[model samples]
Target: MNRKTLVLPAVIGLLAPVLAACGGTDGGSDGGGAIAVGTTDRFIATADAPAPLDPAYAYDVGSWNILRQTVQTLMIQPRGEGEPVPEAAESCTFTDTGNERYVCKLREGLKFADGNPVTAKDVKYSIDRALAIKADSGVSALLSTIDTVEAQGEREVVFHLKTADATFPYKLSTPVAGIVNPADYDKGKLRDGFEVSGSGPYKLEAKVENDEMVSAVFTKNADYKGALTVNNDKAEIRSFKDADAMDAALQNGDIDVMSRTLTPEQIKKLSIDPGENVELIDMPGLEIRYLAFNTDAPGVKDKAVRQAMAQVVNRSELVSKVYGSQAEPLYSLVPATITGHSNSFFNEYGDPSTDKAESLLAKADVTTPVKLTLHYTTDHYGAATKQEFEVLQKQLNASGLFDVTIKGTPWDSFVPAQRKGSYEVWGMGWFPDFPDADNYLAPFLDDDNFLKSPYANSVIRNTLIPASRREPDRGSAATSLTEIQDIVAEDVPVLPLWQGKQYVAARDDITGTAYVLNSSSTLQLWELGRGVSG
Candidate 1:
């Protein structure tokens, strides 16, 4: 879910598909290809979303991958497992206990890549423009709580929120809140093309071929005054279309690291034998995949129909058959790693019992062999997506209660079609915009959700979500969050499939590979370096 509408950000999360971009430096000794990353993510830019690199419109992980290095937000989610730390701002805190009015003091002499002074006005302008240009979707919804922003002199900016929200700081850590230069970007519309200008650890120059971003060289921004360390002088992020070529590039020493989407075959082989000079790095994952149905669709519109399908499908079988134990079966939209996670779906539909599925349909007066078309993207989620859908079709059809067919659409078309509720049922993968459980549930369940499905429960959206956001200690909101999961499990608008563990294949000489992908799914390129171990 991305630009033009709000669907992309919630569906796709903030990232496009893979690892971020940087410039070329060199080998283990420091000479070209220093941090060349090979990823299978193909960035699709439509007329509605022309600027994939602009912070005002870059919501997908692919664009966020570049934005994290090229731009700095008010706060930064540190490389590993710490809370978001200040980057552009020296220090920021809520001025009042209500969590509505917040204040941030800019660090002394912070400047954009162009060497222009970054003042309170720029911060105000960046936030204000993002709000004003809400004509299209970015991750602007994340910043929706911001009622107004006022710049007090050069070093200070004040934020007034619509309601109390403790998750505001975490939202600031995302690419949506990234600080931008006033001179380089348009205030009313999204900046066109892949070029980016921001004040972060790096200055990026991207290469685009036929509307797709191919390479972006990230040279260290000497004028950047942020908390992150710049390990490499230059870094290059190369996007590949083929997983085989990506693996070949990593093995052949043409690329230092490979991430985003790795094939199951590659993961299995790499785990067994990582070959000479290669290391397989697996991190705690914040990514999840699920099946969402359009609530108004003919075949699955009835809640009973949706519930029956959810009961028949077996998440354990799919994860094992596809990921080969690289993923865990998810019982809720919120992954287990997140706070307030629960096995609400499992508690309701424990086993893959055809009897349970048949009974549910019979009680609802839905005829036998309910026809359903499961839609998935061909190019976006990698090779396993097709097989995953095929397995899903087989599982449902074999149950004798449903007739399911799978359709694979290209990403560019799939996204547009999803916005129009073209698919009765479709598969989507979400990477959290922040670590909070609200991020996982709100985007799909809210009344103003990104999903075309009209799935809305006032208690969960207006009541439960606001309640969770009000609590300063996120852990204390467990009861409310757990209740949301239970409601979602009962409604069955979206079916939880499986949660994934992130994998990054890096050369032995690449330092900071472990810290590249943080819990928030933002790739921290500043952590990557050659010829050093961390």
Candidate 2:
């Protein structure tokens, strides 16, 4: 994919990947029938919970991959563009100078796959219903700033914000903003079962599930009205329990393309010497991994204790031994790609040093050999996690400053463990809801934070965040953003570990794998086709 420097409406810097330019000079790929894609990602809440296809309840990559193809948002990031272009709407903008009031006018003749009219009222219902349900596992926190949404006539929709938020436009481009048919979705509950009625290029033709989503079949919707181009007539998405199965599926020609949850070894193999018919496509990755501390937990509650542990963990060594070439060391909350990125952790804690850690603990009068448990998910993150945590245990134990125990839990249970405070410190990861400095910092700082932390700083929560959000030009807010990182480094609520590099492995003949992810990193299945691009 060709990289383009795009300055978004908020004036933040982005290295957007141009899929259109790389697809072909004439633009787009040759006509194809259907493409089968495979992954080892989990989408549903559980076997007994709501349907994984419901946009209102879905939050993970597996769910978003399907939702982004079938559902249409008010605005969308065009192929490789950082800023959003109108999709369901003809145009959208902030009407007020304070950036508190936003307005959108619907596109003419828009209709859902079910042939239902796409109206402003349905838009209101979609957003309002999501907020009303407010599922703990849902995307409510992302839209917490929205105070209310109202429909004006049949074409216009107005969003009233609780406070100034200049980056609201980027948030609208995410899959959580995906619109659904009001007649099908519940008002204050998640719609169970796999049927989906959307307005995007494809409809969920059939969805199969056993314990989790097994497979889903999507076919292009003739009634669909949107800005996206449908290159293939149909797309089949398959799920696997492990990377080995997905990798074998790709190798055996059972699946056309495989992504997400590819092991580091598999990535290395595909990157170096792919099979005769295989190809590797690399894209900029914003996914980051870190360890979040339960600030109230014993042995890790002290600021000095957290800082001492941070001083000893070598990020470079961790990534090298655990992730290999697939990841790089991360030193701050915001990724290096976004504006206002800082290496606060590196600046504060230079290299792995036991002397420094020992001194800090001594000054704080902390007891030696602090007992701690490091928790990681056995299934959700991938096979590398158990080894990653074991390496972490070795590093901490070698310092002789802590007695560590490593524990593994399945994702379905790991989520509940965090809520129950089952672990003192645990592995957590984030692929920004949208690419912005605010997206990285705001969620953790706010009261509705996903951090599950007792750590609080008034300056970060009350001052720096609000000040940054008030600035219309996000780049100008760099001072505040950097200050937030600096403060986080000092506090050590979460210790940054590593940032992943994105790679997509596919057969050489498959087209638009480079174009699959838009500016926001949501998979656009319509971009995929059988033959090479024109």
Candidate 3:
């Protein structure tokens, strides 16, 4: 499925650069100086890319979380643990009239950035376009039940679902259902990347093609009726290639914040770096890094073959050598941050014992010289991905059980190839939507999952997922997901290698850095500003 890549307005040429310096402010106090925020602006924030700026198209939590505050959803997910609750809509009622008909009443005063009051019509148009385009992964399947969305009135949108989906409201909380400005889109496309606008708190200050893109915060819109989180007056995003450069900029007083994973090696250096105010905030990350098998491909289709490969992965060695203990060994695809996460695979295979792996492979009749190509992304994640794969290849080959060939691709090509079942085995990572166990299980277990792993166990797929989804309460759903985890543990289609620990080194002058563990990918732009006392 080659979806059309949306060509957003080219990122505008670099605007006059602002001076980067630091100052202190108390809660709700304006910085009076620039607050520089940094990230690796690897991908242009656009709809055509794997991750886009629009809530409707952005899949990964990295960009979507930023979009969440900027663009309001029909329902807002609570920033902390637990099930998603309503935000933009006062209440949504589902009528068991078969086709999963859901009627929602919007909270008063909701409006887009353009000052047009948000109405039922806008929601319908946003959802309809998603179903029509279906190329952007973020919005397509999430709106699974929406057969038709018709405006019942100005404040109410009625959704006629295609099936009896009881968990429809949960889907509404996701950013994919974000309402868009009708005037900005052209036949399911965005022409003005620079002018790209949303109903969110901040607006794009200017767009640059692949260069630095910036945005500024405004007082809550008079038409806007949702909750606002940040206390900062404005935010400036400067994209960098790696954490070192980001740290360097922070040291030079070129940026106010550096919020992303810096390797453990970098952490050690930043701690001692002169003039670098390094802060270590350890919150549960919403992301999971794993080795996915192309189940459709030969050699990987066998469970023992997959398990043998899984057992050979020396996670400790990978972490020690490549990540330097910054990451924890993983057992299942589920990250420890989520409620129902379990070390299911670790409970079974904790050590990288080649003898045990060989026995299992022998029992399954897998002979020596088992060979396959391992693919990894060169530009994504961090510098350690390739080293991680290199270490993996050495461990497996040293065992004399398998021979390995490694291939590399950039994140853009790597994503499509992995999704389209193009690789035999590949390295991949995930950042969950709302810190739920179902996000780890349901998205990966589906026979047609994005990773293209068709590991469909009826127990986990049909029953466990659907059951978890129906529970309005996440606690109950987590129990169901635990059962799903056990099933996944039994059939290891994907090997959980390690859980990443995010490392951010900020200048000592920056303060009010609070980690809300709910959305691991969010920077919580409001809670941060210049140091109140330093």
Candidate 4:
């Protein structure tokens, strides 16, 4: 969710006539070299929705990605493909003592965007504060095993874990671990974010809801050291509410970048050439969408009833019709591209049919029609979700086993309503905090998991996650993740539907845009510059 915003003058010397002809009399297009990026809708980071100024509260991946551009992780993940290597912190390793303590030494001369030195205490404060505020912060759950974070020296920070948590490094790599200015954070209070502060390459200039965000280069910051691929002297984030509007702005030269909303067709149409003009990249996304059956809700607690509803879902048709073949058909709760995904669910329930659904319903003694409600977010995700639910309704009705009702709330209310267990069945999607299978299983499989869907399997809850956390080996972790996936499929708390894709469309003038990292979806800002000779 990190955005690279730039505010600078652009030289429109020769394009003045062109701008005039296109009705560009406003001062938005100026002299120098600046680029404007566009997205659909507004961004609200309020006390109620409180987007934390610190990374510890960074539960929103989008928000963290934006913060990543403004700050630095102890280890920066590379933009291109490969296992993560060290970035800001020179090297990191666990202590030999059986206490399972891990330590990271900061790279010397790393300063905040405001010129304050980054120290070991800053790191300790960043993590501990998140844990301290976990009652209100969604991010505290991610650091569950962290027993204590103590500053060892001016340049070093040590983490004492409750147990052998191998994923601690990966958790630290998340934006939530982005180092903050200790001066801004209080022991247990949210900080004011209007004045921008961080050690990243860009400095915040303006952030108006649904309007635009602007940033300028932090020229004196030594931490940048040209590590970033995008160093677009300046960056701008302009919001829009619809794909068509976003498309029009890009085409009219009002926006230089796009995220999320543009469809495959829109991207194809915008690209002057498939690999050239418009940068088109389909990265392996960490997001998985499915129908969550609130097992605690009446009637759905029955395994047969859950299986019956899951059977009635025509995932193939849902992908083809709702997603226009842009998304892949998902069978396991985990998507196939992810390391641990398996086809166990597909193997068990191959296709949608009344016979299979009715058989399961009959086993549950549901001879009479079952009435169910499916909930979704109206403005979130994409337009296809509504149509996807409609198709679900039609498919379930076609089975003659259930009568269904579909409801939707705006994205804001959607989360709260679902958490209150207000829906019998609802469609939800998860974008991993980190690109790992454990993130997918641990959050959803545990009985006392977040979202409280009452979907839990003792094998997954108590056995699989603990084993994977303590395995201490990459190969073992992958195998353990796969086993957890199998157990999740068996429990049938959530039925996999389809995996989502990140689609971006750009005008022919934008270059170096194709290589942006898909995991964070944040442009390096420095890498984006004017195209080959205008």
RMSD in angstroms, all models?
6.6, 3.9, 9.0, 8.5
TM-score: model 3 vs. ground truth: 0.84
How well is each residue in 130-222 modelled by candidate 4, as lDDT tens digits?
Answer: 778663335667777789888877888888888777767777767667677777767586554534467776666645544222322222244
What are the per-residue Cα lDDT tens digits for candidate 1 across 1-534?
010100111222233222122222222334444578888877656785677677876666777888888888988775445456777888999989899998999999899988999999999998888778863443677888899999999999999999998989888888778888888878998888888888999888777788887887888899999766677888888888878889999889899888878888888888777777788887677789999989888898899999998899998899889987778999999999777999999999998899999999899999989988899988777889999999899999999998888899887788778877788899999888888898998878764466656777889978999999999888999999999999999999999999987888887777766567877666777777788432
Least accurate stretch of 10 residues (summed lDDT) in model 1?
A: 1-10
lDDT of 3: 0.65
Best-to-worst ranking by lDDT: 1, 2, 3, 4
Global local distance difference test of model 4:
0.64
Q: Each candidate: what lDDT?
A: 0.81, 0.80, 0.65, 0.64
Point out where model 4 deviates above 4 Å.
Answer: 1-32, 45-47, 52-54, 97-99, 135-137, 192-196, 209-230, 271-279, 520-523
**What TM-score does structure 1 among the candidates reach?**
0.92
Candidate 2, lDDT over the whole model: 0.80
| Model 2: CA > 4 A from native | 1-32, 45-51, 532-534
Worst lDDT window (10 residues) for model 3? 12-21
Better of 2 and 3 by TM-score: 2
Best prediction by lDDT: 1
Q: TM-scores, in order shown? A: 0.92, 0.93, 0.84, 0.85
